[model samples]
Target: MIESWVINDDSPVPVSSAGVVEALRSRIDSGQLETWLTSSSGRLLAFVTNAERAMVVLLEGEGGPGEHAVDPGAAGSSDGFVLSNGQGDEYPDEDTVPIREAFRLVEHIVGTGSWPADARWVVDR
Candidate 1:
């Protein structure tokens, strides 16, 4: 797993549901998370906080949503958990870099204002 920290507040002020959805869809389709896939059977798990301050974790794999209703504190201070299968490696530990990278991408594409100040990404094995 890899993760990094990104601080951006460029454009796209006050992220909306549509914006969040679009960001997620784009990231998924952009081949950005391919390196993080756990395996051929592995998947990407995205946990996000909604505009209503409700938390939802959506698995980008086959089985569909596994959990819901997770509180992520304030609305704009949104933080997310991204699970990336480590696949088979000499290392087996959780990394939070990917989370940072994902946040950076979102922040860049979304402009900035919509980006949360406390937004962080964490990757787990």
Candidate 2:
């Protein structure tokens, strides 16, 4: 099954990619976030919403991370439609990379500080 964490976090941290991931993990570990989406076997998406901004982050069963912005209210419908499309969006674009590759980069960044500063800003996963 695919597990997803969704939370509303607006902490003031350095504006960096690592900061983002840290925030996510912190929220999850603090029990301030809950699983907003769940599945047995497919793409998992989590929608994080706050008063000023919202984000939809997705992790494929065998892929890495892809995130995009979403309307606070449309997250549910958007995730539903994506899942209904057979594990991929019917209308994919060039802004995102494959999940495995992204995850590999994330791992390297965490271990050696080789940041994947170029990971695409995905519109859909």
Error of 2 at 74 (Å): 18
Compared with the true structure, the alpha-carbon lDDT of candidate 2 equals: 0.36
Pairs of colliding residues, candidate 2: 64-99
Candidate 1 residues lying further than 4 Å off, grouped into runs, are: 1-13, 32-55, 58-125
TM-score quality measure for candidate 1: 0.23
lDDT of 1 by residue, 9-88 (tens): 22324344336445544544553232211112233333222221222232335464432222233223423322234232
Error (Å) of candidate 2 at residue 89 is: 28
| Clash count per candidate | 13, 1
| TM-score list, all predictions | 0.23, 0.26
Candidate 1: C-alpha lDDT: 0.32
Question: TM-score of the candidate numbered 2?
Answer: 0.26
- Say which candidate scores most in lDDT: 2
RMSD of each: 14.7, 15.1
Candidate 1's displacement at residue 45, Å, is 12
Candidate 2 weakest ten by summed lDDT: 76-85
1-125: candidate 2 lDDT, tens digit per residue: 22222222343232243444555455544543322332333444453322122234555543655454222222322121123123423212222223344333433333333334654344443
